[model samples]
Target: MDRLEAMAMLVSSVEEGSLSAAARKLNIPVATLTRNVNDLEALVGTRLLIRTTRKLALTDVGAEYVATAKRILEEVDELERRAAGEFTTPRGELVVASPVQVARLRVLPVVNQFLALYPEIRIRLVQSDRIIDLVDVHADVAIRVGRLRDSSLVATRVGALRVVTVASPTLLDKYGWPETPEDLRELPCVVFDSPSLSPWRYRSQDTGQIYTIADVPRLLVSSPDAAVDAAIDGIGVTFILEHDVHEAVIAGKLKYILQDFEIEPIPVHVVYLSRAAMPAKLRRFIDYAVPKLRELLAEFGRIPSA
Candidate 1:
């Protein structure tokens, strides 16, 4: 038996709680898993598992061996990868996740360009609004917008999005721009559905204080994209990320309002689990992406940190 392969199979079997599951994960037959494990037990001269019809439980010796096996396998993998010049030559599949619109606007272009430079790297992008547990989802990296929750992952702040209040040129011309937060209550308003946002909690640069807008929604939308569209059609003034309407703002269809009174911009980040020796694929991607993201979003974003 290949002792290293047996050790790996035994570790997988114990963790998975079944030989069948381990076999499925490793893409090997259950018989092969059984044969290797039996061989491993014969070599060690002890029973490693207490197996029944439905479940497999680890023996005392098996538990200790599994722990040691995992550490040994990790070291072996690192040694082999390094020996093959993997640290210098990036070649592997990268799994990444991001919210839908952000993925399309922020991440997709960067990934597309990256594929051109490294033909060996394949990308699998998972788009969802729900925050995924990187370890559970088996994702290698993620693009995070807004404030992040507590996590052990390494977060590199890329830039700050200009989440400013905006209105159509026609509405501004017809009604004129409001001078104070209180003025918004009397004007047509667009309300977006989000938990983190509060109509009252905004930094007012004009007064150098947090200002509360007592405005009620003249129109409510589920998505920020919809709010921007409503504002462009002369519906009402709405708070939106500047990047979403970068082209329209330049085309004079929409106008940014209360620049001096705009609240603090939200942060954007790229987050991943740290490793002792980082893989070339992940390291190179981060190096290639950070500056490009800063540059691409320069028109509608601010780099809060160097």
Candidate 2:
């Protein structure tokens, strides 16, 4: 048995939580994965995994071995990357993770320019609304919005975004304008349910106090774009990032009503794993992307009327 390959499979199985899941991730058959893992256990003269129908658990020894395996594998990967001159040259695959709408409007343009400048480098952009662990997904960098939790990851602040409440003129005409956040009780609202930003909270500029709107949403949607669409169709008022509705607001399709009560601007950042020796490709991309993104987000963060 190839010990290195088996070790990798074992680690993958532990990380992925199942032999079948690891098999799918590695693009290998489940039987092959199982046999290799079994072989690894035999070679070690001990059982590493406690298997069940629902999940896989590691033995105490297995847990310790897996930890050692991870370190060894990481060292191997680093050595290979060094041998490939990734440390010296800006030539390698760079994985960047970003939100869906931001990827479409903000990040893609910068990526296009970066690719043109560095032909030896290839980029894989993973766009999703869900927040993913960078190390778990093997992403080189991630564009994150809002306040960041305390962690070991390095972050560079790019810009800020206002979360504004907006409604179409037709809807406001029917319901009348809300003079305060409390007035939303009788008005309809389109809520974009998301983990990143909350649309229901508002901050007062004068008092610096946060308040929650108790309005029951007429339309509750998952996607910000869909919520914006619902608001445009006069379904109800919706809260969204200012940039997402800039065009519609300018076109008179949507209007910002409660600017004074808008929540504090959400912070944006470019984040990556903290490392002692960073690869040239990642370093180059951060240098090239940060400034451009800062400029773009600044523009996006601007409220058209306010």
Candidate 3:
């Protein structure tokens, strides 16, 4: 028996969930595939799989062996791809996760352009606000905002971002506008439930100071989008990421206040699990995404070369 080929067959069988499925993928007969697995178990002097009519289960030893086999196969596949001059050709499923707004405004366009350039690469763009379990979701990469809680994942700095206080023109016309952060207390405020908890932040031009404004909100909502809607409807002032309110501000739907009191830029990142070697598809996407994101955020200004 060819042990390497048999290992590949076993791995494929486990992944495909049935011997017949593996057989179909490998284009080999079911009997031939079963024989190869049996021969492999015999050669290894142990039963690797427990076969049932409905399902195939890996034994404890089989489970451990399968992990080792997968690593070996990946390395072998990389070697083969490199030898064939196909290692750098990006072609595979690439799953990425990001906050809903970021994915829609920033990452989706890049994803579209990337797919156009690499037709063979399939992408799953997971738009979410809560932190996603990369392993559970099988996410290959993630675009993260603010500080990352998980230190285990490898993170690359994208750029810094800031929050802005904005209100709709209709709202501004109804309620008197605040010239400074302290003046916000007189007007109704819209609170957004986010990781930031809607803490109003500002930087002082005269004293060169930055501080968080502690004002109770008249209206509160679970999402930034909702808060913006309320603000646009002449409800209250809301604090949100500058990017989130960019369109509304540009289209004259919303207007910003206390621009002089804007907060210092917060870091943003692209994080992924630590890998023995990054897949070509992932590496290429990172290379393509980082600079583009930075460029888009550059209007927010760079972090002064620290």
Across 126-181, the per-residue lDDT of candidate 1 in tens digits comes to 98766777854557789887788857889999887777677887898889887765
lDDT of 3 by residue, 75-113 (tens): 787677566544467877889998888898788988898
With a 3 Å backbone cut-off (N, CA, C), the pairs that clash in candidate 3 are 202-261, 203-261
Off by over 4 Å in 1: 1-88, 195-200, 205-207, 211-216, 301-306
Residue 167 CA error for candidate 2 (Å)? 0.5
Each candidate structure's count of clashing pairs: 0, 0, 2
TM agreement with the true structure for every prediction: 0.66, 0.89, 0.66
Best by TM-score: 2
Q: Candidate 1, TM-score vs. the true structure?
A: 0.66
Q: Residue 216, candidate 1: how far off, in angstroms?
A: 4.5
**Predictions: Cα RMSD each:** 7.3, 2.5, 7.4
Q: Which is the better candidate, 2 or 3, if ranked by TM-score? A: 2
> What's the lDDT for residue 182 in model 3?
85
The lDDT per prediction is: 0.80, 0.88, 0.82
State the lDDT at 178 in candidate 2: 91
